[model samples]
Target: MQPENVRQASYRGVEDPQRLYLAMLQDGEHDAREWLSTQLRRTASMADDLPDDPAQLESWAANHAAQVATDHTRYLTRRHQGAPRHYFANRAHALWFLQQVAPTKVVDGAWLHGVLRHWRDFRFHGLIRTFLEELGDGDPRCNHVLIYQRLLSRLGCDQGLPLDPSRYLQGVVQLALGRHAEHFLPEVIGYNLGYEQPPLHLLITTHELAELGIDAHYFQLHVTIDNAACGHARRALQSLRLLMPGQCAKAFYDRVRQGYRLNDLGIDTPSMIVSFDLEDELLAALQRKRPYGQFMHSDRCRLQGRTINQWLADAEAMPGFLRALEAQQWVRRGEAPSHSRFWTLIDGPQAAMFGVFTAYEKQLLHDWIVGDTAAEDCRRVRPGQWERDLALEQDAPVAQGEVCVDRMIERMWGNRHATPNGLRATRDFIHATGLTRAGPN
Candidate 1:
């Protein structure tokens, strides 16, 4: 079957395989009855009909690489020639866009982690090596996810980690779901290819963000790491050859194509750029947080005709709510109105609605109402922070003298294999002994 056909088939019977898989977990579905696992198995079964031909498989891989390379060159040339408008209009625009897409970026290869673990568990060394390289040999500092996080932090974009899956773009969801299912290895590899293949978006993003004065290290890193000639893209192709040699070739290629096609299913950079409406996004952000804060205030707190609770209830009603507040002279736009009651509630420390929105969320609201003319200072960090944060603890304190039991316990507690539960139990045991720091009682 054609790769596009396979992707369409995979999603045909499900409303959204990504959401459905999440629901199945919440519903405690397990083993064969589990929706996610069932889907994985069904996907894997699709390749069962392909005949394994090693020569044909090698030819397909070469052709895939050549085609991808040609496409990459053509895209780059076209983008450069056209000199299209920046994906983000300015620094603020870039920051908001990054914050919106940060979740997907931060969890770069999380789904692949499952596949890596599976390979390790089953002693598939070839697969293990391929995935391990992607993970930078399990180094936390060098890990792509951590690198992205550092970029986010450096830019003062504090969206935090593990964002809600619902916030992800459909394309991001497709890539993630493909990796996570772990049923079709070929498809996952295909996804790796599609994802890692040097794209025009990364180049444009890096250049545009740099022009906007935001650190584009994350994009820059990916450009180098996923280079089609000598990086993850090349490695991904090599992996297919290594893992699916001989009789497994045909089936693997079929699934890989499907996974590759999945990359085309979601929003692309240019599309997101064109679709981003700051006003609409601000309203939507407030709306998402509305239900949680709807009953926060009573009728007595009504500013014009509606209570604070009433204003927070509906997204469509919010503009009118703001207008009402303006009519009551409670808020003044286009300036930092420290005395504005609504602004105070949305952004103040001691306000009743504190901690309700994210920094990015507040930034959006602040920019929308107050305008982007305010002189906002960028949060700067030391260049060494990334290296310092990721530095490996390579040594333990050596005991020169005869070790006491407490010292021994402490040493044992610090071992890498010590679990949190085990450490807690050990601490309890120590406390129960009534031993003071000076001596045992």
Candidate 2:
């Protein structure tokens, strides 16, 4: 039966069963693991194309299936603490974890041509595409769309201000030809922008790090960042602190104490501010061990120097960063912010990851503000009567025109929503414009 070969099944629009099978595992369906294990043995027996020895075949099938399952659990447990709901900071980390769990079909896009010649992964490419799409719709504070637009352009997509959504996530990047290009994710409604570019920060709780199978003894060696002091860089270090293993807490405390006394942050001295260069050092540290957080400090890193005295002042200066930090604790409580929280998530062990998370939030804000450009066009073209018609529509009851009005509301002012303050501004605009609904007349 050999599963009828994927090519043969293509006529029926059927894909390789392995993908469906793997998806089930990823979805955490109750019977997925058990069913996959049983199916492996059956599939092995039915496969006559390979070796004829049933015992060897079954052993191989079982091992492969088990390994796939094991990797999935291992990585998931480490990063997510087995919760599956904990936020991840960046799409790269998510993509990387997915690759580790399943490698067979995760190949490079063909368009990458000879660019990413060393890589191969179709599913990975698709997943990234899907994520970008969902991210645009799901979060108002998203900045990734434009940045990805640039990344896609590098892959040879056409030039444009607003990105072509399809090409941005789906195209292949020619990493071979490029070196150190920075992209901006503009300030959007719900998200506060610290840098036009990313690598905002990484945040990790001590509990999450422990689950990663890292020992606390090497906390200093383990949690290194590219530059310290840039807002994102500073937050990454603080978040990494939560990850200190219980055994290493004393050592961690001692080091921090020593660094404090010496007017240095010890291993964290680098974190006091952002640095301009350190990519090689960063890559080496990550490869050696999972560094707590690494950040692409803002372009300003070149200007900010490392010093404990300097850091205390720097932290005091970034009001947005401070508010963002306070609001994040509230986010854990599921409450709206009383005051604006901007770049707080950019600091902590998970700050880099937090940056990615915040980017999506920012996108949500941007979407809310832009709203319906057509209305603006209509206002210009049709003029006064259309305003009267819009006013008339507002008098209708929710049951009659709620959906349409909601759609109109979103369309007309989506872009105005890049931040909580923006929402207030929109409300003020509505009031000023006399746009409030009167319900059924």
Best by lDDT: 1
Per-candidate local distance difference test: 0.53, 0.25
The TM-score of candidate 1 is 0.60
TM-scores for the candidates:
0.60, 0.18
Question: What is candidate 2's lDDT per residue for 98-215, written digit by digit as tens?
Answer: 2221221121111111111111233222212222221222122221222222223322222212211211111111111011011100101001111101221122322232333322
lDDT for position 180 in model 1: 50
Which digits, one per residue and each the tens of the lDDT, describe model 1 over residues 270-362?
Answer: 565656666766666767778888886677888676688878876678768657777886777767746566778867789767887776666
Shift in Å, residue 204, candidate 1: 2.7
**Model 1 spans > 4 angstroms off:** 1-85, 89-96, 99-103, 111-130, 149-183, 208-215, 247-252, 288-316, 325-357, 370-390, 395-441
